[model samples]
Target: MQFTAKFNALAVAVVAAMVSQVAASPAPVASVVSTDEFLKWLDTTDADITYIGKPINGSVPRAAQDVMVTYCNKRTQNVCGGTCTVYNGPAACLAAGGTACLSATANVGFCDRGGCGGSCNQLSTCGTHLDNGFCFTPGTASIIVPPS
Candidate 1:
C-alpha cells in the first residue's frame, strides 16, 4: 500500500511539472489584436501602446462606430501599409459623423524584434520600425460604449 501511495505522488509531481512548462511557453503570437485590445489602444497614448502586447501581422481591427487610427507600413508587403483606421468588428471605431473608421491593412504585422526588417538604425522613436501602427491620439474620448 505504501508503495502505491509513493507511485501516485511521483506521478502527480511529473504531471505538475509538465503543466508548468506548457503554461510558461509563449502564446502563439496573435495574427491580429483582439477587439478589446484594439479599443483600449485607442484611448492609450504613444508611451503605453505596448501594454497589450504588440499586434501580430495580419490582425484585424476591432474599432467601434466612431474611432479612428493612423497606420503605417513601410515594408509595403501588406495592405495596412501607411495610415488607416478600424472599421467594423469586435471593437469597431466609428467617426463622430457616424462613418466607419478605416480598417487596418490586411497584410500588416505587429512590430516585433524580428519584424522590424533590420532598419532599427534610424529610429529615435518607433518610426524607425516600419511595421508599427498608431491610433490617432488625443484618441477618441474614453466613453464607455457597448461592444458591437
Candidate 2:
C-alpha cells in the first residue's frame, strides 16, 4: 500500500510539471489573417496587384463572395512585392506561375506542380513567414483553394 501511494504521488507530480510547462509556453501565431485585414494590407502596399477570374469592382464586397489569394514574384525585406496577381475565387487549382511569395485571406495549400498534383504544403506551415502574413513560397507552381 505504501509503494502504491508513493508511485501515485510521483505520477501526480510529473503530470503537474508537464501542465506547468505547457502553460508557460507561448501561444502559436496565426499564419492566416482575416479577409478584411488582408484586403486592407493590399490597399496600403505598393505591390502592383492584378485580379484573376472576376475583377473586384465597387459593386461587390470581395470578402463576402470570394476567397482572395495573392502571389508575387519578389520578396524584399520580408515583404511580398513586384507584380502580384490576386486570384479572387474558389478555384480548385490556381496556376501560380513563378511565384516567390504568397498570402491569402484563407488557409490554402501550395503545391509544387501546376495542377496541384505534386507535393503540397499548407500555408499555415509556412517555412519562411513574411511580413503582413505572407509566406516565402519560392517555386510555388499552384495553389489549392479550399472549398467554402
Candidate 3:
C-alpha cells in the first residue's frame, strides 16, 4: 500500500514537470524577407549557393502565402576539365559546375532537412544561411508581394 502511494506521487510529479516544460517552451516565428536584405545578408553569410530552380505549388501557410520559398533538389554528375564529379543538390552542384551548369538542371522539390523548423529572413535582419537554418529549401524563392 505504501509503495503504491509513492508511485502515484512520482507519476504526478513527472506529469507536472512535463506540463511546465511544455508551457515554458518558446513558440515558432515566421516572416517574409526582402530582396535587398537578402543580397546584403548573402554577403554577410558568404554561403556557397546558386539558383537551382523554382518551387512547386504545395500548400503554403496563409501568412507565408504572400511569399514562398521553393528549394531545389538537383543531383547529377559534372565533368570539370576532364575531372568528373558527382553533383548532389542543385545549389552545390551549380556552384561546382559554375557557368557550365546554368543551362542544365536535374530535379527539384521542397527542401526538407528534417530540421527543427524554418521561418522568413526579413529585411534589416538576415536569418540563417542556406542548409544551416533559414534556407532549408534550395530552389528559388520569390516574393509574391513586396516586403511589408
Candidate 4:
C-alpha cells in the first residue's frame, strides 16, 4: 500500500539523518605530552606553570608527585626526580616508573596532600609539575605541562 511505502521512506530518511549527525560530531581527543617536553617547559618557566581552567600556575611538584606515587603504588621513588620521562596518567606512571608510562584515559581526580583535588585528562590537564625551591615561592617550584 502507499502508506507502507511512505513509512519505509520516512525510516530511511531518519536513518540518514542520524548518520549525518554522528559524522558531524567532533571526535573524542586527549592531549598527551612527553616528560621531556614537560621538563623543558619547566626549565623555561622555572616551575611557574598553569593550565587553561586553573587560575594561577599549578607548579606543585610535591602534590603531583605524591598523587602519581599513590596512583602507581610503586616501591621505588626515582620517577619523581632527575631526568625527564613520559607519563600517561598518575596510576600508569606510579606503577611503571620511568618506562614511557600511560595514565587513565578518562574520569579521574587529581588529589593533593591536603585532599584538595581536581579533574585531570590528557590534553586539558595532562602533564607533570615540579617545585625545586629555586623560584622562591615557598617550598619547591612546581612544574606542569601547560594545557593546550
Which candidate should be chosen as best, given TM-score against the real structure?
2
Total backbone collisions for each predicted model: 24, 0, 5, 16
**What ordering of candidates by TM-score runs from best to worst?**
2, 3, 1, 4
Q: Candidate 2, 79: how far from true, in Å?
A: 0.9
Task: Compare the candidates by lDDT and give the number of the best one.
Answer: 2
Q: Distance from true position, residue 20, model 2, in Å?
A: 14
Candidate lDDT (C-alpha), each:
0.33, 0.83, 0.30, 0.31
TM-score of each: 0.26, 0.74, 0.29, 0.24
Write the candidate numbers in order of decreasing lDDT.
2, 1, 4, 3
- Tens digits of lDDT, candidate 4, 1-148: 9999999999999999999998896754333233334445445532222222222233543223222111222112223222332233323212122222222223232332122223223323434422321111111112232212
lDDT of 2 by residue, 1-148 (tens): 9999999999999999999998896753457777666778777988888888767554467655467788999998888889999887765689887999988867789998989978899888999999988999988999998864
**Cand. 3 Cα-lDDT:** 0.30
Score residue 143 of candidate 1 by CA lDDT. 16
Instruction: lDDT for model 1, please.
Output: 0.33
lDDT of 3 by residue, 10-60 (tens): 999999999999889663233233433333433454324543334322243
In angstroms, what RMSD does candidate 3 have relative to the true structure?
A: 14.1
